[model samples]
Structure formats: C-alpha cells, structure tokens
Target: MLHLQVFTFNPFSENTYLIYNDNQECWIVDPGMINEQECQELFSFIESHQLQPQAIINTHAHIDHILGVDVVAQRYNIPFYLHELEMPVLNNAANTARMFGFEYAGVQTKPGFLSEQHLLRLGNDPVTVLLVPGHSPGSIAFYYEKGDWVISGDALFAGSIGRTDLLLGDHPTLIHSIKTQLLPLPAQTAVHSGHGPSTTIGQELNSNPFLN
Candidate 1:
C-alpha cells in the first residue's frame, strides 16, 4: 500500500496530497499551502520521514490549487506537472487572486505538462492519468489500478461537484467527465478528493446530488 498524507491548505482549503512509497520517495499532488506554518509542516514531515520528493503534480492550475508550486519546486528542484491547457490559467493566478480581492504571491506559470502517455509510479503502484476536463480545461485525475483508488481533483466532490462557472469550465463536460472517467471505476474504490472528506465511488454515484 502507498503511504498518503493530506494537508488542507490556503484560504481555498484545497487538499494537498503527499504520496510516498516504501522507498521513502514521494510526489506532491496539487500543493496549495499558503501560510508559513503549512509549508513548514509539509517540509518537516518530509524531513522527518526522510522522503525524497521526485515531482510536483498538479491536478489543474487553479489559483488556489497551485499556490505551493513555487515553494516545493524551488526547494526540491523538481518540476511541476499539469496538463498543457492549464498553462494559461496558472500564468494568470495573480489576476485570479486579485479578482477575488486576495493578495497571493509566487504565482508562476512555469511548470511541465502531463499527458496520458506520462505515468507516475511509486513502489508497485502505477498511477494512470485520465484527462478529465470540464471543471477546468486541463483538469485530470490519477487512478491507481492495483490500489483501487482515484485522486479526483476538483472534478468530483462529496455531495457536490466542481463549479463550472470558472475559466474553461463547462457543465456538460464536467458531467461527462463524471459519467465516463469517474463512474467506470470499481464501485468499492476509494475516492480521494481535492477538498472535503474522502468518499467511495459507489457512494458518490448513489448519493452525490450532482452526480445523481
């Protein structure tokens, strides 16, 4: 089994996931930590556990979700990974934050893109990349087949779904992503979301007001 740690960070309360394997090597998923304490906690955890961070993976490039991209990228000398389409969104994080009347620094648009051909594996687990657009043009989800788990970014949520009013978001596409990318997973598979508590694929299929 993979070792997982979650940190709810930033004013947006984005759930950043740290995934590591038995070798003590790991990857950062959508690290949006805003405050010093959050960053310190994350770094402290890595130092204490002796984890070598290999990569920075972004589910999408929303302003709230990519806040810590610079911190980790600069500190670890690792590249940030996102879909090609999210480059513009990431580049405009400052504007997004400004529009919301918030002051956020380190809004950069320089990160690598991840395609279906690219794969991220830790230990024996291989994370299959699924380009799940709709919540955002380049939103993607990572599925660990053997582990029976899916890390759903902002595409799907508990009792709800990601808002489509934002940039490049379409309600129809979001619905399609849910029906196709997420619903096909095994019913018992655990769904780890970008925010809120974790839920099962079966539970969301049956109970999520948006999905139903």
Candidate 2:
C-alpha cells in the first residue's frame, strides 16, 4: 500500500506531499517549504522514517507550490519533474512571488518534463500523468490507479476549482480539464490538492460549485 504524509508549509499554506510504500521508496511532490522550520520539518519526517526519495515532482510551477523545490531536489539529489510547457511559468515564479509580497529563491534546477504519453514508476508502482492544464499552461496531476487517488496540484479543490486568472490561465480550458480528466475517475477516489483539505471525487462531482 502507498503511504502519504502531508506538510502544510510556507506563507501560502501550500500542501507538500511525501508518498512512499513498504519498500521505503518515495517521491516528493510540490515541496512548498520556504523557511528553516518548514524545511527541517520535512527533512525530519523523511529521516525519521528513513525514506529514500526517488524523485521530485511539481503539478504546476506556480510560486506557492515550488518554493522549496530547489532545496528538496538538491538535498535528495533527485531529478525534478514538471511539464515542458510550464517553463515560462517556472521562470516567472520569483517575480510572481515578489508581486505577492513574498520572497522566493525560485527553483534553480532544471526540470525533467513529464510526458503525456508515459506512465511514471516509483519502485513497483505506476503513476499516470494527466495533462490537466488551464490552472497553468502545463499543469498536470498524478493519478495512482491502485490507490485510487490523484495529486491534483491546484486543479480541483474541496468545493472549488483552480482559478483561471493567472498567467496563461483560461476558465473554459480549466473546466474542461477537470470534467474530462478528473471527474471521470471513480467516485471514491481521493482528491489530494495543493491547497486546502482533501475531498473525494464523488463529493466534488456532487457539490463543487464550479463543476455544477
């Protein structure tokens, strides 16, 4: 079974996730730590569990979601994965943070772009990559079939959907992505988002205002 630990970090309260299995092999997603305390917290959890981080991934390159990508990737000496189309978004992260009155070092490491045609493997498990853009030009979500859960960056929230007012964001495209890519999943599948609380697919489908 896959195990997950969530650390709500940074001024943005972004949800960073560490996912691992019995093998102790793990992946870090959206490392949102921005200060010493937050970084130490994440490091402490990994060290305490003796987890071996295999990869670093970002569902999107928005400033709040990637504040600690550089630190985490460097510490684990792992490859950072993001969609190729998000390069522009990644490049603008620091500036965006500044506009928000937050200082971010920005992710300095080059990312290995996720491919729409491929499945990501962590040890023996397979993770499906969904190109659910519009929240950002290259926003994506990770779906684990066996676990029946999706790490949906800033896409679908508990009772809302990702905003389409940011750079390259489009309301229609975001809605379409959620409907066609996310809603099709099983009702019981858990939706793990980049911010706020977790919700099930069924709950969102039944009551999410934007979807309705």
Candidate 3:
C-alpha cells in the first residue's frame, strides 16, 4: 500500500505531501516550505524514514505551493514535474510572491510536463492525473485509485472552493471542472486539498456550499 504524509508549510499553510510505497520510494508533491526551518523539517522526516525521493510533482504552479520546489529537487537530485500549461504561472512566481509581500528568490528548476494522457508510477503503483483548471489554467489533481484518495491542489476545499479571483482564475470553469473531474469519484474517496483540513468527497458533496 502507498502511504501519504502531509506537512502544513509556509505562511499560506499549504499542505505539502509525501507519497511513498513500501519500498521507500517517494514523490514530493507541492512542497510549500518557505524558510530554512520548514525545509529542515521536510528533510528531517525523509532522512528519519530513509525515504528516497523520486521526483517533485506539482498540481499547479502557484507561488505558495512551490516555494521549496527548487530546494527539495536540488537536495535530492530529483526532477520536477508540472503541467505544461502552468508554465506561465510558474514563470510569474516571483512577481506573485512580491505581490503577496513575500520574499522569494524564484524557482530555478525546469519542469517535466504532466498530461491526462499519462499515468505516473512509483514502483508498481499508478497515479491518474486529472486535468482540472480554473484555479490556475493548468491546475491538476493526482488520483491514486488503489488508495482511494486524490491530491487536489487548491481546487476543492472542505466547505468552500478555490478562489477564482487570481490571474486566469474563472469561477464557472472551476465549478465545471470540479463537477466533471472530481465529484464523480467514489463518494468515499479522500480529498487532500492544498490548504486547510482534509475531507471526503461524500462530505463535500453533501455540505460544500459551492457545490450545492
């Protein structure tokens, strides 16, 4: 079975994830660590568990979600993966950080593109990539069917939904993407969001005001 570990990081309280299998091979998802302390916390866990990081896979390129991407990728000598369409968002990271009054040195990692056409693998486990935009134009989610969970980056939240006021954000598109790509999952499927606490699809389906 694949195991997931979540770390709440940065001023944004973004949830960073580590998905690993029994073999200790892991993938770091949306590393949001913004300071040395946060970065050390992430590294300490990996070292303590002897986890071997395979890659840095992101659901989108939002500034808060990628603060530590370069650091982790460089530390582990791993490649970074992001959706091809998110390049514009990634390119604008520094400006976005500045706008939010955060100090950022900008990301130097080159990303490999992810598409719905492909499945990401860690050992024998396969992860389905769901293209769900509107939070950012290239927003995506990672679904691990066997694990009955989806890592939804700033897409679907517990009681609310992703804010559609940012650059390229569209409320209508985000809602449609949620209904089409996320809501159809098994009602019991776990939803690991980018921010805030986690919730199940059934719970969101019943209580999420944005959906109703």
Candidate 4:
C-alpha cells in the first residue's frame, strides 16, 4: 500500500504531498515549503524515515504550489515533472507573485514534461496522469489506481470548483474537464484537493454547486 503524507505550507495553505510505498521510495508532489524551517521539516521526515525520493512533480505551477520546488529538487537531486503546457504558468510565477506583492524565489531545477506516454511509478505502483486542465492551462491530476484516489490540484473542491478568474482560466473548460475527466471516476474514489480537506467523487458529484 502507498502512504500519503500531507503538509500544509506557506500563506496559501497549499497542500504538499509525499507519497511512498513499502519499498521506501517516494515521490514529492508540489513542495510548498516556503522558508528554511519548513523545508527542513520536510527533509527531516524523509531522513527519519529513510525515504528515497524518486521524483518531484507538480499538478500545476502556481506560485503557492511550487514555492519549494527549487530547494527540494536541488536537495534531493531529483527530476521535477509537470505537464509541458504549464511551463508558461511556471515561467510567469515570479511576475505573478510580484503583482500580488508576494516574494517568490522561483524554481531553478529543470523540469521534465509529464505526458501519458511518460509513466509515473513508485516501486510497484503505477500512477496514472489525468489531463484535467482548466484551473490552469496544464493542470493535471495524479491518480493512484490502487487507492482509488486522485490528487486533484485546485481543480474540483468539496462544495465548489476552482475559480476561473485567474489568468488562463476558463469557466466552461474547467467545468467540462471536471465532468468528463474527473466526475466519471468511481464514486468511492477519494478527491485529495490542493487546498482543502479530502472528499469523495460521489460527494462532489452530489453536492458541489459548480458541478451539480
């Protein structure tokens, strides 16, 4: 079984996930640790558990979601992964933060593109990539087939959906992606969002105002 550890960090309260299997190999998804303390906390856990990082991934490249990508990637010497389309979003993170009067150190590690052809695996587990863009041009979800859960980043929320007011966001496209790509999953499948508590596909399908 894969174990998922969540860390809420930075002003955005973004949820950073560390997923690992029994073999002690793990993948870091969206490291949001902002300061050295936060970064150390993450590293300490990995060291304490003797977890070997396999790769670093992002569901999207929003500033809040990638604050620590640079630090983590460099520290672990791991490859970073994100959808090719999100490069624009990632590239714009620094400017976006400045506009919001926030500081961003930016990601220095070279990132590999995530596509269906490029499989993401941890030990014996296979993680499927779902192209559920709309929150951002290249937003994606990591679906763990064994757990029947998806790490949905700012895409579908508990009682609401992602806001489309930001740059490159489109309401119609967001809705369509949720309906066609996410809602079709098993009702029992858990939805582990980027900013809030977890919910199930059935819960969102039945109650999410945007989807219903």
Q: Cα lDDT of model 2 overall?
A: 0.91
TM-score per model over all chains = 0.95, 0.97, 0.98, 0.97
lDDT of 2 by residue, 1-212 (tens): 78788999987789999999999999999998888999999999999999999999889999988888888888999999999989999999878988999776678898998976469888888899999998999999999989999999999999999988988999999999999999999999999999999999999999998998
- State the displacement of the C-alpha of residue 7, model 3, in Å, after optimal TM-score superposition: 0.3
Give candidate 3's whole-model lDDT: 0.94
Which should have the higher lDDT, number 3 or number 4?
3
Cα error of candidate 1 at position 39, Å = 0.4
Off by over 4 Å in 4: none
Question: Which of the predicted structures, 1 or 2, would earn the higher lDDT when compared with the native?
Answer: 2
Q: In angstroms, how far off is 113's CA in candidate 4?
A: 0.3
Q: Model 1, 1-212: lDDT tens per residue?
A: 67779989987889999989888989999998887999998999999999999999989989888888888999998888898988777777778888889877645536777895467777667888988889999899988877788889999887888989987789999999889989989999888898899888999989988877
Give one digit per residue, the lDDT tens place, for model 4 in 1-212: 78899998998889999999999999999999989999988999998999999999899998889999988888888999999999888988889899879877578888999974355778878888999889999999998878999999999888888878777988999999999889999999999999989999999988888876
What is the lDDT ranking, best to worst? 3, 2, 4, 1
Ranking according to TM-score, highest score first: 3, 2, 4, 1
Off by over 4 Å in 1: none
TM-score of 4: 0.97
Best by lDDT: 3
- Let me know the TM-score candidate 1 reaches against the reference structure: 0.95
Ten-residue region with minimum lDDT total, candidate 4 = 115-124
Query: Each model's C-alpha lDDT?
Result: 0.86, 0.91, 0.94, 0.89
Show where candidate 2 strays beyond 4 Å: none
